[model samples]
Target chain A: MKSLEQYTRFIEEKIAGINLEEEPRKLYDPLRYFLSLGGKRMRPILTLISGELFQISNEESLSAALTIELFHNFSLIHDDIMDEAPVRRGKPTVHIKWNSSVAILSGDVLFVEGYQQLAKYTDKRLPILLKRFNETAIEVCQGQQLDMDFESRDDVTEEAYIEMIRLKTSVLLGCALEFGAILGNQSEETRNHLYHFGVSLGIAFQIQDDILDLYGDPELFGKQVGGDILSNKKTLLFLKAKAISEASKDARFGDLLQMAPTDSKIASAKKLFEEIDAKNASLETMNGYYSEAINSLDQLESKGLELGSLRELANFLITRKL
Target chain B: MKSLEQYTRFIEEKIAGINLEEEPRKLYDPLRYFLSLGGKRMRPILTLISGELFQISNEESLSAALTIELFHNFSLIHDDIMDEAPVRRGKPTVHIKWNSSVAILSGDVLFVEGYQQLAKYTDKRLPILLKRFNETAIEVCQGQQLDMDFESRDDVTEEAYIEMIRLKTSVLLGCALEFGAILGNQSEETRNHLYHFGVSLGIAFQIQDDILDLYGDPELFGKQVGGDILSNKKTLLFLKAKAISEASKDARFGDLLQMAPTDSKIASAKKLFEEIDAKNASLETMNGYYSEAINSLDQLESKGLELGSLRELANFLITRKL
Candidate 1:
């Protein structure tokens, strides 16, 4: 089986080959442009990795991989528009590059294209795959909605915040793995195990992202650290800090919230988070999910499906630097 | 076979029965509110009608019918947001009712819900049905893009406008019909005929809508007469008038465009459209599509499937009061 890196390169070539109708340049140009600003392509690669674990060839699983990637981009386009975000991956977002209308319609076309790609799978599992895909699509939208809703409300609980992140970020990763397993013709029970493996990894990865926003190595992380705190985003780290402050009556944490977003604010918030043990608490939770991910892999290994690649990938996610 | 009225009532009931996630009220509420502002359930009815012609029972075809309805509403919500349309069917548009983000995400969830409804089809035809749905969905986006593109350009030709409407408005009607036909186990040749029947009917219906905005019974139509003209919309009728004016260098028509949109301008524009035979020209085009629609129905009839209901529906669309 090809390594995860090889699968990612293969997926890159496949994405480069995607053809969209050229006439409505306004409708399709944004899609082409957005896809051109490539990210890690982690989600699609996961589909391939799961397929490898299930002994499905990359060719047989490529459609689902592409579908996941296309759907991911579609969500980003619409989500960016919703957030009124200006840039994605250091470039103008689709909405900013063209207009919101173009973003909405192009994102929509990309969504339909994802479904079209999935329809290429002419297997007995197509219906089940379609069913799971539709469910995950709706869940992702709900996740985005919950995330947005959390931003405006002060009543967002720690549990609710985790659920939002799960819906928003993690479910699609789980879905990618599940689709791969389904296409490999694995039993539903086996697919569920692999799916949980993905879900746990995604949750851990997201927590790491939250932690890194305040604690990442400046030279290595590439982005401005503490950007989340500066933006007042209700990330898991912030929620954890709030939970600890409320339990301990920590007035210093409340004062940190009142500070204007500045370099000093970032440094002070970082120090406060560490002192209240909020950072430590978040790290514990992240490790919990990380351990849960490994436990899922162990379950898969017990079933005699070799998971060396998936195991390495999980480890990379946990130990990832940037 | 159920009468069109009975089928409409059935669809109305099904629409009312739709359930969405309750926790994220922000996401699902807009969907519920938009669907509540009911219009003629024309598209879904076509799905059931096509099913009946192919001897697929209404009960069996309800899922496809509901799928079409949900998809139609999904497109409407997103299109309204794109157009910044303030109202739909005399109620606030989803964007206006909630906000653009809510509308975008809610519309997305509704689109996913449409696919879930479609997945209820357990037959071998599900894959083909999904393929057509995705194709039509993409075409609709392209059509909307072209329509928006036409809004800012002076170079939009009459031919391009028709193709835009065909993509934006006609293809889904065709798809709704085609989906039903496929579910009924019809041959590809037979389904194409039924699909073309819907397409031709949709095109003719849209042209009639253009004519009605200028000349419909104000009391019956329930909208201000010549609203399209006053709004400076480059509808088919205006495009036809422009084409005529360009050919003849009719200075009066050119002056009419520069005139402020008022009661006097509407009257003069209506008179000019008649005097220059633009209205007559559009009527001929409409009739051409109407005849094409009938010819498709005739082909379906030649296959020994009864076309009474579909034929009546087409005639109703062509000669309806409003």
Candidate 2:
């Protein structure tokens, strides 16, 4: 199996090969700029790694990987607009660099381009791949809607939040892995296992993101710490902290949660989070998902396929400090 | 061959059968509201009528027809947001009724739902159909971008305007017909001819729309006369009048064109348009396209298919007041 580094390198090269210099410079330029801003490229790498596990050729998997990456960027463009975000990856977002209308239209073009890439597949697997892709795409939109809906309501439950994240974030991961498995001609059972594995890992990844936002080293984390707190984001950490503070009748914790982001308020919030074991509780929940992911891999091992890279990658994702 | 009314009825029934009521009511509700507003449903009718031309069953073509309709509505939702217009089909647009964010996300889900409909076809035709759909979808976005671009510039030529309309409006018409032709198992020669036929007819239809916007009966037009004039929209008539007035140095025509739409300004602009024969020029251009479209149908007639309904439909579209 290829290393994660190799898969990432392969995916990057394929992404670079995508011709974004089409006419209507206004539309295509923003798309090119957005893609060039570069996230971790994690979703496409997962697709490649999963495809390699199923013995699918890197060449055959490139289009599917590109599809996932393009779709991810498309979501980012639209989500950034909806969020009224000005920056992404330390750079001006497409909507900021161009305008909202340009961002929206370019994002739409990017989506259609993703399907154009998917249409390159000629095997019998194409129909199922397209179907799963459509479902995943719809789920991602629904997830965004729920996330937006949650922002206006104060009574959001943990269960509702998890379901929102699953729909918004995790399903794309599952869909990526499933695309690879399908291309590799893996059994349906194995495909389901990989999908579940991706879902669990994705949940863990998101929770880790939540944890890191408030706790990670500033230099290593690549953004301002306590951003979620500043924005009053309803992440798992904040939700748990709120729940614990309310249950204990801790007025201090409640004050800290509602306080504006001064250094003291942020520090006090962190102290309270530690006091109530919110950090560890979040970590424990994350670890549970990690375990579930590993169990899924173990189930897939019965099929007699090597899963060394998958295991290694999952470990890296769950444990990464950055 | 089916009558246009039969095709329209069939498409309406199929559309009514589609269930959009599901979870995420915020997202789906706006879509339901938009679809219920009811445009002419012209594109899908063309698909069904073209399908009948090739002896394809209405049932077999239903999914494709639905795909075209859904895509059209999806484009409308997003375009309304981009245009920031308050009304569609004489009712509140999705963005106006709900919000831009809801409109944007719902439009996205609507696009994916269109693909979901496309994925229902599991035959050799699926790849080709998807390829055409993707291409047509991309072209639509590009066309919209050009339309938006034209809004900011005053030097847009008649040819450029024609190309813009082709991308924005004509290609979908072409795609709808080609989809029907493909499903009908027609020859490539026939498919190409039908696509061109749709394109030419689409251009004629748009020009006719421009004419009706200025001259049609108010009750039948269902819109305020001189709206394009009021908005300074650079339609074929406007561009042609500007060109004629500029070339002849007819300052009255130039003055009328630049004047804001009051009753006097609209009346004067109409008088200037008649003086410069802009109305006749536009109708002549429309007839040129109509002839090109009929010529395309003539090429298809070598295959011994009856095209009377297609001809009648084209005539009806060109002659319709609304």
Candidate 3:
């Protein structure tokens, strides 16, 4: 049973030693540069913890965790190029640091490395593991396509958003947990429960992120709070804000939002938000998903898997402000 | 056995059915457009012919061939972005038609779908097939990196250029053949031989392309001849020219070369190339690799594999002026 810090530290340590930096620098230097700019790395930790829930960690399970992390980072690098993102984890993104073409090619190499890492597990489970991984990879891409589509649409509903996020974000988490469970020789029934736990938690995490985008304290959030609201991005908060407000009340709100959320607009939008109770509405939705996440964990507990450490991890995640 | 034209026609027919015009049109449309702006379909045809050699053909093989072609086109789209090239086959590139970011993301989705199509293979050979495919994918990225690096170096040798082309260009062809052979359930030894056949042929094919770039008749080639020469690109021709030229006579050659490969430089370079017998040098190198390719086919024939059709395919490839 690893503590949250312990799992986080393990990921950092493991990835550090997976040195991809030497000569052939052309092929691997960008990989090293990009992976070093870390995220929460929750996917890989879910893998490690899920494997630990079943039994002692082995080379097979560890490699699977590393493989998923590599794949996850690979997606991020490419996604940054697509999104024209300048920063990742408060650091210059790979594309920003080098160039988009280099980032594109490096991400391709990272994906190939992920597959190579998975191929190291040439055992009885190889076919199943590879097949599942390949399918999940496709799903991730579908999710990304949906996200891109959502960008251009004004009609994105909450349901579409949830499904989009699930495809783009949740499936990988679920796959990470399920892959680890499979490598640990968990029963199919147990793997299914683990997957549910990961997916439910992923949805909750995204919802929380949406709420935070408007309501988060900038000191703690590490990003521009209310940026999404400024863009009129159809996050949960904006969707709920649009939903909860009446047509008669739209006049004052329309005036404030029409300015676009700059310094002046920020104060104005916050005033309208308070008047309409958008933060509270967003929080209520976030709590709903958070409770659903907890309910899934409870369901997992009923299946007789060790729940103490997992519950703690879940608590740490759901309770976090960032 | 399916002739190369039959396989090419099969790919053309398959690709013809794909609807490139759809909503959220940015992602899939480029793939459709690129596929429609056709090339020789050489790699996919190789995949199919290898499959035919192993007695594997059907709708599944057709889908697999389409996958290879789609994947190849996907790479070309991204490569055009990387190279900032405006045209492909004298038509505008996807990035040129749309934008760079769209081209990047669209190519990614295409790569993802390529795997999805390959996953349609119900054969037990998928795991090994995908493993080899992933390796080749990485080599392609590495090859691109080497190509980029070669641009910065003044001393790029003939060996380095050939190796880069082999990895970036030839390996994919080899992977295509190997993928088809694996799906056909051919013997491992036979699959290895076919892979070598593809690799050798790829090398010969690329060398032929270098020759065509400088010397092919413009009408047949469908583009300006000597475009590579104009760019001062470190092609096999340039390397050979550098190698065969007298040191004192060609001493100022290095400084005169420019990035854009202008009309003035092109004429001068061509003059110097013939002066030092670089055309002969390049042709000799091309012939050497072509012989190696034919030797690889001979080895396959020696193993009692029916190679008559393959030899015809090779002849057709070698005889192409464009």
Candidate 4:
């Protein structure tokens, strides 16, 4: 099996080969620019890794990986516009660099381009793959809608939040892995196992992200620490703190949240989080998901497949600072 | 072959059967609302008519027609947002009624729904249909980009304008017809002929729309009669007027265009259009495309197919004031 580094390298090379310099320069330039401003490339890498684990040919799986990456970028471009975001991955967003209209149209073309890549697959599994992709794509949009709806409401439940993150974020990871497994001709059971594994890991990864947003080293996180707190974002930590504070009849947490996002206010919010043991609770939830992910992987191990690389990758993902 | 009214009724029935009331009401409601606000339903009707002309099964062609119509509405929702359009078909646009974010995400879902509808086609023609759809979808975006780009520039050539409109407006009509033709198992030659026929008809239809934007009755048009003129949109008429005035070395047309778009200024622009013979030039060009469209139909007729309904539809399209 290829190492994770080999899969990452393969994805990078494939992305580099994608030419986005077509006509209507305005439409494609933003696409090229957004793709150039790279992310972790984690989703595509997951696809390649799953393909390798399933003994798929590299050429057979490359297009699926490319499709996953392109879809990810397309979602980001549109999401950035909706979020009114100015920067992404330490660079200006497409909507900021160009304009919203350009971003909207370019993002749309990117979506079609992703499907165009997917249309290259002509296997018997194509229908299932396309169906899963469409369902996942729609769920992602629903998740975003739910996320926006949550922003305006103060009573977002933890269950609802987890479901939202699963739909918004985790399902894509699951879909990517399942896509690779399908291409590799894996059995339905193995595909389902990998999908569950990816979803559990994705949920854990996002919770870890929330924890890192407030507690990780500033330089390592590569973003403004406490950004969620500043924006009054109802992240997992905030929800947990609210729940704990209400149970304990403590008003300090609520008071801290209501304050303007000054340094002192952020400091107070952090202190309140510590006082409420929100970090430990969050870690507990994260570890539960991590264990669930391993349990899914263990089901695959019972089928006699080596999972050493996947285990290491999962550890790396859960333990990463950024 | 079905008459135009029969085709229209079939399309309306198919649209009514489409279920858009699935979960996440915020996400899907706007889609339902947008689709409910009716337009000409011209593209999908063309799909059905093309299918009928080729003697394809109605069940086989209905999904493709629904996909075309859904895709059209999807583009309109997003385009309305980009154009900052407040209304469409005499109703508030999705973005205006709800918000841009809702409109953007719903539009994204609508596009996915179109593909989901396409995924129902399990035939040898599936890949080709998907490929053509993707290519057409990308071109539509490029066309919209070019249109927006033209808005900020003064040097757009007539050739560039024609290409832009072809990308923006004509290709989808061609694609709708070609999609139906492919599903009908038509010969490649016949499919290409139908596609070009639709393209030529589409171009002439758009040119007629531009003409009506200025000269048609407001009640019949169901929109502000002088909207394009008021917005200083460089429609075919505006471009033709510029070309004609430059050829005659007349400055009145340029002067009129530069004036504020008051009622008197619109009157003066209309008079200038008459003086420069821009109306006659536009009509002549429209007739040329109408002829080209008929010629393509003639090629289809050579395949021993009757062309009465198509001829009637073409005449109705070019002759309609709105």
Kindly list the per-residue Cα lDDT of model 4 for residues B1-322, writing each as its tens digit: 6666777777777777787757788898998888777667889888877887878776778888887888888999999999999989889999989999999999999999998888898767777788888889988888898999999999998889989999999999999989878997888888899999999999999999998888888888766777788888999999999988898899987788778878887788777887778988988889999999999999999888877878988998998763
Separate DockQ for every predicted complex: 0.85, 0.85, 0.46, 0.76
Candidate 1 has an lDDT of 0.89
- Could you tell me every candidate's TM-score relative to the true structure? 0.98, 0.97, 0.91, 0.96
Fnat for the candidates in order: 0.84, 0.76, 0.44, 0.78
What's candidate 2's i-RMS value?
0.6
RMSD of each: 1.2, 1.5, 3.0, 1.9
- In model 1, what are the clashing residue pairs, if there are any? none
Q: How much DockQ does model 3 earn?
A: 0.46
- Judged by whole-model lDDT over C-alpha atoms, candidate 2 comes out at 0.88
Per-residue lDDT tens digits for candidate 2, residues A1-322, read: 5666677777777787897747888889888788877667889888888888867778888899889989999999999999999889989988888899999999999999899899999768899899999999999999999999999989998789889999999999999999999898878998899999999999989999999999988888777898888778899998888888789887876677568777777687688889999899899889998999999999998878788888988988877683
Cα lDDT tens digits, model 3, B153-197, are 988888888999999899888888887778878788878878887
Docking class of 3: acceptable
- Superposed model 4: Cα runs more than 4 Å off: A1-3
Model 1 vs. true fold: TM: 0.98
> Which residue pairs collide, candidate 4?
none
Candidate 3: how many backbone clashes? Answer: 1
What TM-score would chain B of candidate 3 score versus the native chain B? Answer: 0.91
Give the better candidate number (3 or 4) by lDDT.
4
Model 3 TM-score, 2 decimals: 0.91
Winner by TM-score between candidate 3 and candidate 1: 1
Chain A vs. true chain A, TM-score per model, equals: 0.98, 0.97, 0.92, 0.97
